[model samples]
Target chain A: MSEEKHQHVVPYRVYVIILIALLILTFSSVGITSIELGEYTVAAALIFAVIKSFLVLTYFMHLKYDKLYIRVMVGFVFALFLVVIIITFLDYLFRT
Target chain B: MEHAHHVEHPDMYDEESSKIGMWLFIFTELLLFGGLFIVYSIYRYLNPEAFHLAGEELNRTIGTINTVILLISSMTIAMSTTALRKGHKKVAIALVVVSFVIGFAFLVNKYFEWGVKFSHGIWPGSEQMLAEMSQGEILFFGLYFVMTGLHALHIIIGMIIMLFTIRGLAIGKVTIKRPSMLDNCGLYWHLVDLIWIFLFPLFYLIH
Candidate 1:
């Protein structure tokens, strides 16, 4: 067999930890809905979701161990996504 | 980079390049769903009450179950890669199989959930939705079905890929040195879970 290139074996325990954290966040997001936060509810839920995605991307997808170029590529894509969302919101918020 | 340029072996594989290609594909997927999400946001902003009311009609318990199932499956698939790297071929295969089963379970749950909704005449373009629901509510359910349906399609595709990966593993084609195929499949599986992470909160947990 050829030598494994860029082989970075993450410990099994870390995956378990990330999984637990993700589950907890999922529950917390559900629990937060019971409270009467009004407009803040959606914001709070989305924040937790963002954090959960970050964990999945960094750990489960091995982006943390991946090269810098890949990281930059992902970051750019997300940034562009956010910009498009914000621009769309601007139209909705300002239209008479 | 160095190996690909120098080696002329027929079996030569560039795992790094393959991974980059997968990431690029994932980016396109993100943008594709990102467009849908924007449309959801606009409709929600326009008709907040209808969106919230429609969200209440969804079954939270089932949504939570499906969320947990997908998260666990994601872990199993990610760990399968580790198992493969450690040379535990059987364990790795077992983990991938577990992921596949759990993924199927998720779809089954979805089928029932959609069944309940359909029975209630809540489907898009249904006479009940058209006559009874507000414009915003109709739009909400429309996006709901379209987004989740697209996601289910992705899950099915991912499972098919996993099946092939298992076949490769069984034939000794996928080894520690040639693990890129499994790695790419794992990434795709995680992307499915990543999309669900947001979908759960957006569609089910809104109050």
Candidate 2:
């Protein structure tokens, strides 16, 4: 409670650059998914989405600038989410 | 720095704890949507063909436009947060208003898109859906409406939150020294966009 944390004010230029990158990723996902990639299509699209979400989480959500405890909490939450999905898929996959 | 403003509002403003609390709330929201995502995956796996076919009926162009719209809104809100922290109240409010307008545009697009589907009797429990669509297709549309409907609802709520944050900024309740309110609201706005990142590919681009 006595500690003074130096608040990181992210630069507007950085936000602009991130926005441009997000736009590129958005269009790239759209263009690539439009092609016939067979089974890999879903995989490709999801990869783009995961990257996009990562950017949003890290920059826009201020997770990157936040303290370690906050980052750890977010990481834990997402990791838990992934584990749930994996386990659920296991149950579905191994069903007799 | 915080001590300078400590006297202004004696109410203990624990920034880190406040942010932590918001994150905890976000985890719950994530799980709520996460449950629906599980349902979607199971059904999609069970009925891939039907899900794929039904996914085709959705307008990819409109979906892409909405995706861009949301991404823009997310950027503006994020920028607004930075602006507020940097002591540019007017710029901050302007960015949020931009976000609000774009968000409304997104809803308008969704309304028309849903209207088109409704006109074709494509809603849940519609006679055409039940009689014509396969079970998988029905499930696909059902999930579509449920997922997208819930998402649209979030967008509306986020916009409303933005309005309040704007008012807070207008009255000087939220400022450079006390940016927690706007920061939390920005977090929520980004969460809405984060969900759509997954929803777009799953619902619209899966053909």
Instruction: Give candidate 2 regions above 4 Å deviation.
Output: A1-5, B1-10
lDDT of each: 0.93, 0.91
Q: Can you write out model 2's per-residue Cα lDDT over A3-66, one digit (the tens) per residue?
A: 5537888988878888888889989999998999988989999999999999999999998888
Give the per-residue lDDT digits (tens) of candidate 1, residues B102-171: 9999999999999999999988899999999999899999999999999999999999999999999999
Q: Relative to the unseen true structure, what is the C-alpha lDDT of residue B110 in candidate 2, on a scale of 0 to 100?
A: 100
| CAPRI quality band, candidate 2 | high
Per-residue lDDT for B1-207 in model 2, tens only?
455544565689878777888889999989999999999999999999999899999999999999999998898999998898778999999999999999999999999999999999999999999999999999999999999999999999999999999999999988887788889989998999999999999999987
Best by DockQ: 2
Clashing pairs in 1: none
Model 1 misplacement above 4 A: A1-6, B1-9
**Model 1's CAPRI class?**
high
Count the clashes in each prediction: 0, 0
* TM (chain A) per model: 0.92, 0.93
